[model samples]
Target chain A: MASRILGRLPLDEDRLAQDMARLAQAPAPQEPYEVFTIGRWVNLNLWNASGDDGDGFFNGHRQVAGRPTRLLGGVPYIGELLTTWFNTELLTMVRARNVVEWSIVPHRDFLESGPAEDFFRVLVFLEDNEHALNSDEDMVFHMRKGEVWFLDSAQIHAGVNISSRSRWSLCLDFKAGAGFSPGDVFARAGDYDPAIRPALVERAPAPADLPDRLRALSAVVSRHNIKDIAFLLGKVHFTEEVPIGASWDWLVEITRASGDPALLDLAERARRFFVHSREVYEEFSFVPA
Target chain B: MASRILGRLPLDEDRLAQDMARLAQAPAPQEPYEVFTIGRWVNLNLWNASGDDGDGFFNGHRQVAGRPTRLLGGVPYIGELLTTWFNTELLTMVRARNVVEWSIVPHRDFLESGPAEDFFRVLVFLEDNEHALNSDEDMVFHMRKGEVWFLDSAQIHAGVNISSRSRWSLCLDFKAGAGFSPGDVFARAGDYDPAIRPALVERAPAPADLPDRLRALSAVVSRHNIKDIAFLLGKVHFTEEVPIGASWDWLVEITRASGDPALLDLAERARRFFVHSREVYEEFSFVPA
Candidate 1:
């Protein structure tokens, strides 16, 4: 699994409703960052190092050097709840809102200049809207109101609001080393169920593991899983920085080792569809000058 | 313009026929560098360094350090013809053949390792067949028999042999600094015509020139040219290593400057289709771990 719901925080719906009522009366927040998101998605900074309302430093590392300042007066209780639940200092808190049928473009949060593992985030849904948070590996979760989710911010992810009304989520950023271990928190919250966890597909599997992995993949190469597997392979190649040629070689070797002719054919088709096709070139051929 | 026919070489069809006959009778050539090409494309190395028949070092730089060793006994005249036409030491020569209905996957050659400008390739069509070479910007050209083309190997390009019969081409690679200039050669060959040259889209445009370029693009943003401009914009973003957020900013500024609502709408749609869409994320998101 590329992402996990670390834990669910126990919270009162009545208190969250009060927070929402106060938030409705508060002034509208500014854009999070210049052109960082698309459509009607907007962010209201609740806490950050700089008290500037426009400072869009949502990553925990950026907030580590300065004292956390509460930017808004309406969401103090939400921040307190997150701080108590995570057992760590909350560096930044943001109320992200997506209007009807709006979406945040898929992106990794701490990618540009920060160490990804140094930051983690929690999303406390404020509205029960038809919205889904999707990871790069195609894993999606429909977060519900009063439900706290420890989101893996390191993965490429996005949010889409499909309901008629706007969707709001209180996003909290926490420094990684501040006595906040997500695994331990999940265990404590009783959400660390291995039975529900998806299979972990490595980015660059060892040559020895290729055959077994391919066999497993072959067994589940239906319409439902093929797209997910394809997305995973693409994410792996990108994250691993593997060259297309080398990646194709691995696919070929894995296909041969699978000893499933259908899988071999599927692999070839996938290479043609996802790799050799013009659409692939247009989308992925980013060779920096 | 993405591609152009540089010049036509004067050669007897009977002589080319004879060469093709001899090539057909010669021992089958080994595959070109592993996984560089796809389908039934094969290379019969006529001249290369290392004197190894399997050595697939066809790039111009690799040939500079060693003497050009003629690999086969037959078709020495073909090499002589290329030597005289290019007016430089021909480092590597290979008879590239693509079987009927075969296609080379769209790809850029010498893109990963070498400076693209350090090498230039010439393709002499040995057999007239229905074939077209496509570039990243959607430019396509068909080579005629006895015609010589100075191929721009730096850009992403591909070849498709659509004819029912095998297509043969004599490929020559020349070192860039060995008193070999493509412009000078094309001028000397009387094939340099400014009237026929297509528009030049710079890989990296200066910041000052961006506004004028965007205006020019605006003037031509018809339904027909939108896709090409979109592709060019994508190519620019990738080649310039511009972040998505920054690219969107540019698009927004350009859209406003263009003063064209249609163009602005097109830009927004392009963003959704190319950036926020799941298909784009699935194909293009290669994050180096």
Candidate 2:
């Protein structure tokens, strides 16, 4: 009985369902949030928030020190019966995250040099919207979601919005968190080979608890060079170093999205009970859920 | 909405839990009949007396001819809670039929074959003595279950079991069913050429309810010198056929496994409304589940 708790967000099923139906009938999305339907995407829940809104919700990503940043919100969204059903039926709790209006690419008024670079441009549909994300592959699906085509962020990919539909999805990402791949930031930063090191498989059993694809991915990420700091992370990375803007709420969100709240909490409790790693929630750079 | 009853069996949740735990600890089976375990089996609710039981279930193949067979009682066994959780979480209702007892080689006697024709043996472990299975092979994953290699059925290609410990998993033998490719049956029959024939996607819109894989297969099945009987399957083959077996009761078991009686009743109504096509039911074979 090893288990831990992470974050929780309320889900709104009706709104999600309505959005799903609307998006279903809407045409394929395009360059400037044009079309709204076609392809496969169904609603699971809804949350209260929008782009740059103050109700503690976010819609867009920001660039800091040449790095992209995510806004804060407890990762869990409300009204989704699937995760609960999964836990109750399977007896295995999962980590998960929440999404509100985070767009893959900002629907600029057409003349903004097609959005920024260093950022991704996906080429496929994001749940509801049927536009090819210009290499902007942001979503990841777990076993509970048919387990195919779900994108893992660490992988090199991008997308572009070729359709004209509002691009919105309550995206959640999940994975096990442990001091495995994200080695002790305390360890000299350049000491470990960013690409060839092993994951926290022993330290962060999170990958162990996750689905095979993610688990295999953890291995792949471990072997691949970090390339850039913002893109590479491990459960242990947070244990060693402090990064600006990382929030406990963000940790909760990532874990929540992993579909296992229990493990997220476990990471926190592990630091508290064993490592005496007493740091505020928002201090750590990242938490692998 | 479109739905159907899977089946009702002696669904003892507590007993099932206890059985799962006990079986996880059980050793390799000594005999083939031990794998069958009785008291548990294919739930009649999901399927009806119809067609042949393709080797999808792996343990054996049952293709009844002339007369319809009696549908049995039970729930779809996914080898263990681990698998059940993965499947219930990933594919929602996708099943994994682990190899256990079958016509060619019974349980522990697997060693007699010296080596299996394929690497991924459809062997099952005792989870409180329940059965488990897996069929589709869209991707392959390599990882761990408490430090051991974990197998993913999504990727096609066979595997060799070179472990000293028992590997209990749902055996899923993917024989392209009544839908497409004419399967080993047709290829072996030499009635069609695998390379010459265009794949299923090249065909027309298949039965709406069937998964794309199965729909393609349905197209293949129809191409058989068996078109008349195949189309009589109408939407039935697509809707009525369960991953493991095809029977009216299979409908019931799926509903029951959902643990929602309302859904259960939904399936039951379908059974009554569209009485079993006796001629067709008689033709269906019981696959290993």
User: Per-residue CA lDDT of candidate 1, range A76-136, in tens?
Assistant: 6675664565444444444444443333334445644356666667676777664333334
> What tens-digit string does per-residue lDDT give for candidate 1 at B213-252?
4444443343322332333343233223233234444554
Q: Is the docking of candidate 2 incorrect, acceptable, medium or high quality?
A: incorrect
The top-ranked prediction according to lDDT is 1
Model 1 ranges with Cα > 4 A deviation: A1-289, B32-34, B59-72, B93-95, B131-133, B136-138, B178-180, B183-289
Candidate 2 lDDT tens digits, B32-100: 121212111221111212322211122212322111111111222322332322222111111222222
- TM-score of candidate 1 to 2 decimals: 0.34
lDDT of model 1 at position A199: 24
Q: What is the C-alpha lDDT of each candidate?
A: 0.48, 0.24
- The TM-score between candidate 2 and the true structure equals 0.17
Report DockQ per prediction, comma-separated.
0.01, 0.01
User: Model 2, A53-100: lDDT tens per residue?
Assistant: 112211223221111112212222212333331212211111112121
Per-candidate TM-score against the hidden true structure:
0.34, 0.17
After superposition on all CA atoms, what RMSD does each candidate show versus the true structure? 23.1, 26.1
